[model samples]
Target: MSRLYSDIFTNRASTGQASADLSEAHPKFAVNKVDFWYPGKQALYNISLTIPERSVVAFIGPSGCGKSTLLRVLNRMNDLIDGTRHTGDVNLDGKNIFAPEVNLVDLRRRVGMVFQKSNPFPKSIYENVVFGPRVAGQRDRARLDYLVERCLKQSALWNEVKDRLHTSALALSGGQQQRLCIARALATDPEVLLMDEPASALDPKSTNAIEDLIFELKKDYTIVIVTHNMQQAARVSDVTAFFFEGKLVESGLTEKIFTRPTQRQTEDYITGRFG
Candidate 1:
């Protein structure tokens, strides 16, 4: 294994051992020495962080700082982009996700993602929610219906759209569309959910709704979100990591990172001193 991957694997093992000891008290996800590149450009540095299971971990930074890139790496979304390259390791539950034997499709199913923009399909609300399970080979009407209802409820959109399951997804408001996208993500029953500025384009009301939904979802799924909004990070995340120039500058409890960041760069960015 490369040095980066070796370090990552070792760290994941250590974090897993520690997490096992405190399993009843804390939730965690292990990310160790991860790096990524797009064609000729490197987007992430030697990044290592642990996000507790069932907890919210937020990445906050200015544009081009690799926040979104790191988020994509979590669920292997970067693989969809041609010319992309990666090094190091990203592991969940102590399993190295980049290993050759690991199935990318199954990994993605286990680790779902919500994009910056809400991209709902042209299909009906019900169809959107059932897309994942359907692709996974679930053809039973009853199972699809149950999955749709369950995920929609989990995303806090069932009550609003329950009466109109057959309605076109585009007919919904922007806020509703974003929620619908979230519900679609939940349909897969993923263990980890990655969000990249999921509420950035929504109105304040919608943003608040998304935030509330994130807080609620953490009770079941480990969430890793990348956002440029500092207050949003502080509001929703249990732990916050600050990135600058592709490097992870600092990471700690959200309260501390916002209020008492250890690194000067983190303080500068959070305090609006620099991007």
Candidate 2:
């Protein structure tokens, strides 16, 4: 099992296979030998990955597998917590995001995130969608209206809530609320979007809606999602990475990962032997 995991990293040359070397070929976010710690416990191993531009990459694993931890690292959301330390490099556009001179607020603005649960503020739906732009001091009412409409339309929520823009955001259904959260994230015009189980709490219909939205959004932004749902990862992502016990077991094109993964550990987990 260990040897299976080692082959994905050891043999970096392309073999006319889907799991070819992407880490150095063309990477928008290059994570090289990254290790993370939270006080006494190490949360991530020597992880290296290459996420290309305007693509959707899914991280799949059971709980406590460090998939979500790595997602937060891209935008430096982990910096808000105490006793957290990270080593190695995570470069965006070939620039290190962890450098002392890098501005965290700007980094977060460029990289938006949506949590597992829909956390719409108690504000009106229109207010919720435009909050990020407002914070950036965009005070033009006409442009704010345009921004709100554009983001909501992009997120597939405009048609449902266009008539109720001023209604309380909390009054929407769970699925709609999650979509609203996505609109809010998009309002910031981020280059990269990180989603942690964006549709896990939704009904099947809502889940499909989110999946369709992901398909549309990937054309414009780089997206990384951590989803526990194997089917969701297979459905929505172009590439898939499997992690276990703070280590990335394997990664490849989504179809290949689901059908013919190189690593035994990946195959076992996909086949439901263990997570």
Candidate 3:
């Protein structure tokens, strides 16, 4: 690993700060020298990142800087696109995810993802929450009921929709729908949650709600969020990774990366000097 990569696992920030040093946290997912391509162009080059368990890591950079691509790559969401390919390995809990023996379905269940847009199925709210479990051969009504309530509450959506569980999910507001989508992802009992610009489309109030939910959820699930909002990144993430033109420019504690970035490109981007 380079010096920059080594810095990602070091606590360079002072102790009294609000941000805790997460360098010693157990590794949840490790991306090793990954280079990704889509059809005719490359999106990532030699990117390596270590995400600590039960913490939040934010990927922030300008447009087309491979932040979202790396987010999708974590759960192999990029495989759905035609002619998409990558080199190197993405390890989840120290095991290579690219191994042929790995089961994609089970992998995805362990690493649930919420997209840039809220995509609730046409079904009712209750059905949406229980969709993943139901698809996995869970037929017990009582157990499914428990999952519905538990996951909705985890996503902080239970109080608002408790009395209307059977109503169409499409009827909810944009923020509510996003929370529903998060509840749906949670119903799978995922260890890691990958969010791609999850709150970018919502109003300020809704964005704050999502950010609060993220802060609370980090107590249980490791989260990787791809966001363009620098303030949001600073507010919610324990670690921040900045990318530039398909490479990881710098990554470290959110406090250090934002306040004392070691790389010139990282400083420029964060300071609004250039992106």
- Cα deviation of 119 in candidate 2 (Å)? 0.3
Residue lDDT tens for model 1, 1-275: 12432343354355431112223534345778888899899999999988787878899988999998988888788889999988787777888888889999989888999988999999999999999888889999999999888988888889999999999999999989999998998888888899999999999999989988887887788899999887677667777899989999999876667666789888888778888
Pick by TM-score: 2 or 3, better one:
3
Q: Rate the local accuracy (lDDT) of all candidates.
A: 0.83, 0.88, 0.90
What 10-residue stretch in candidate 2 is worst by lDDT? 11-20
How many clashing residue pairs, candidate 1? 5
lDDT of 3 by residue, 107-222 (tens): 99999999989999999999999999999999999999999999999988999999999999999999999999999999989999999999999999999899889978988999
Worst 10 residues of 1 by lDDT: 16-25
Error of 3 at 10 (Å): 21
Checking candidate 3 for backbone clashes, the offending pairs are none
Total backbone collisions, model 3: 0
| Runs off by more than 4 Å, candidate 3 | 1-17
Residue 145's C-alpha lDDT in candidate 1? 93
Best by lDDT: 3
Off by over 4 Å in 1: 1-28
At residue 4, what lDDT does model 1 achieve?
38
